[model samples]
Target: MMIILKSKKRQPHQTEKTIQILKDKLRERKIKSKIIVLENIEVFLNEKRVVMKINNWIPSKRSPVYFRIAERYKNASYIFSKYLEMKKVPFIDNYHTFTRERNKLIQMFLLAIKGISIPKTYYSPAYDSRKIRNAARFLKFPVVIKLTEKERGEGVFLAKNAVEIKRILGKNKGQEIILQEYLDNDFDYRILVLGHKTKLGETRTRTNKREFRNNACVGAVEEFFPAEEVPSDMKKISEQSSRIMNIQVCGVDIIRSRKGKIYVIEVNFSPGFTLDEKMDELNQTADYLKKWHEKKY
Candidate 1:
């Protein structure tokens, strides 16, 4: 069976490496695969029929494809996924699940409603000062302001007071921001879940002493740990979060407060992988897809 990896034209260094690793693993299994950059994709509908061509080549309808598009191109991804579904092509993470999981606010709302522990979050697109002040009052000082559409800790800010909050809001005018209760933790865990199973667990700690966000893109270091070393509760919750999001593969970021309460910070549908752990994740993903292809075809 053919495997297609869809991603942006300009992917980060790590993302490019991860894609190469996945391609290699699939090749080892003798599965035909190719990478399709979304920038080169064109979709057209004529005579009540959908037509999709990637770099002037139409993908086979029988192949299973995986999307690696980032949040910015989510709308395109949604449209492409819908076309694939209409053509009865197999793909990982449908459009609905992909779009919903990309929104941090929506993830927290859905997970919180299901009794999953999440940091208290408030969002407003209008940037109303009264609502901002109310969020400050409800969540208290030292709140976290996160841009709803960003990833890799790009637009995360810590506000110690209303003045700082106002300043941030002013600077980010017209942007949707979510105010979350800041949980003071030294480090957080990034648990990779695939096929409803916890495959790999890692601890992300900020290498910069002053940095509160522990993202590898921003000077954070990641170290792989055995699955058994992770807390049972964390593992269970990570798996549950992925399932609830209707995602087959994801990275669940969980943090533990000083009081030992576990709170899920975020769930990443397209989680980054380090050089050391890339092979393991790709191998498992390939095996799972192979099995899926066997069962379906």
Candidate 2:
């Protein structure tokens, strides 16, 4: 069996580490696998044909298994996934799921529709002052302004009042931003769900005194806990959120409010694993792939 790991040109250091771990595990299992950076692949289209070429070689339709790990090259990933689908191939975390989870507005909408609790969020394609003001009216002060396409808390901001909201909107005139009710909490949970199981859970607390965001990239401290130690409600909601998003493996971010309400903040398609948990997560994923391959082939 051949397993292909597909990603974009530049990936995170942690992503590279996870790839190496997966490769090592697959090697030990004696499975043929390779990492195919989507940037290196070329697609050609014509009135009569469609072709995908990589390094002057055409990949076979028989290449059945694939795992997509990045969304930076979304168009390419979509085309490649369609090709594989046309050939009746199997892959982990299909293109639709990847794109859906990447969009915060769409993700929150879907989760809310599935009866999962999410913070009050407002989104619009065009930045409208009326919409912004209305969202502020509904959600009140201390709302979070998030760029729809950003991750790792890159475009996240806290607006204490309408003035801050207007200023933020003015600065990002053409960009798509969503306003969410800020849950006044010191920490949030990041739950990694694999298959139908919750593999690992961690609490990320802000290390900086002035920072409101609790992203690990922003110096948030992470403490991993066993699955049983996690709140039963959190595990259930995390798994349910992933299922609703059609993600076989994902990281679900859940936040608790000062009022003791649990809300799902985000669902990540390609969540990073800590060095200590990388081996275990990769091995579990490999075992899942093997079982899936056996059942299919």
Candidate 3:
């Protein structure tokens, strides 16, 4: 089996560790796989040649790319989708699906249209004070300002009002942003759904007062929940969200408010399982990928 990792040329320590662990697990499973650690394989894609070195076997095939994003996801799936279409190759999380899932604004739009209960949100390309002022007036107070196309909560902010937004936007200019209604929840849960199976669902809570964000990267504590503990409607919503977004593997962020109401926060197309604190997540993800490859090729 040929596997590729679209990661940074200079990866972070966590990223490197995750890749190492995945490779180790695959080896233990006796799965023949290759990790192509490069992002823009445009030359390889165009020439239809990826010289993969797996063990002593230098198998060469003009096989089309059947993969997901490894680096910045902007236009990642879009470009790959074009290649898939040209080669008539079946792949998971194509461009259209990736684009929609990557952008919080797009996910909100689709979910809202489907009558899903997502927090009220607003997105605007203009970061000028006037627009920020208008957005504050339109959206709920203590809303979130997010960079439209970034991951790991890299560009997310909790804005108290137009004043805070102006201060932040003034320092950084000419960047597209999204203002979302903040549902005041103490902790957030990231639910993983792969193909037709729910691999794992866990809650991430901020362990320190300094870190307000509950993302696992921000030193949040992760704890697993039993399948029976998963809210029934949430299960249905998560499943529908994946199918509607046309992704084989997905991550959905659901907010459980202080008052015990659940709101679908966002959907992730190329959701990452490699760096999960729990190794089971990584192993199961790798195993699922093995199963998928077995079925596909």
Model 2 TM-score, all chains together: 0.63
What C-alpha lDDT do the candidate models reach, one value each?
A: 0.75, 0.72, 0.62
Better of 1 and 3 by lDDT: 1
Q: Each model's TM-score, in the order given?
A: 0.64, 0.63, 0.62
Better of 1 and 2 by lDDT: 1
Residue 194 of model 2, lDDT score:
80
Candidate 2, RMSD to the unseen true structure? 16.9
| lDDT value, candidate 3, whole model | 0.62
Can you write out model 3's per-residue Cα lDDT over 157-267, one digit (the tens) per residue? 887877787877776665556676777767898778778556678888888886667887777788877546777867877777777666778888888878876788778
Model 2 weakest lDDT span, ten residues long: 42-51
1-297 per-residue lDDT for model 1 (tens digits): 565555554667987888889889989998878776775554332122334566456666778888776776565566567656766788888653445445776666557656688887765334456666767766788999888779989999999998899999899975756788899999999998888788778889997888999998998888877677888999899999998888888889999999998889999998876756356656656777788789899
User: On a 0 to 100 scale, what is the lDDT of residue 178 in model 2?
Assistant: 73
What C-alpha lDDT, on a 0 to 100 scale, does residue 94 get in candidate 2?
Answer: 65
Candidate 2 has which clashing residue pairs, if any? Answer: none
Error of 1 at 136 (Å): 1.0
Rank by lDDT (best first): 1, 2, 3
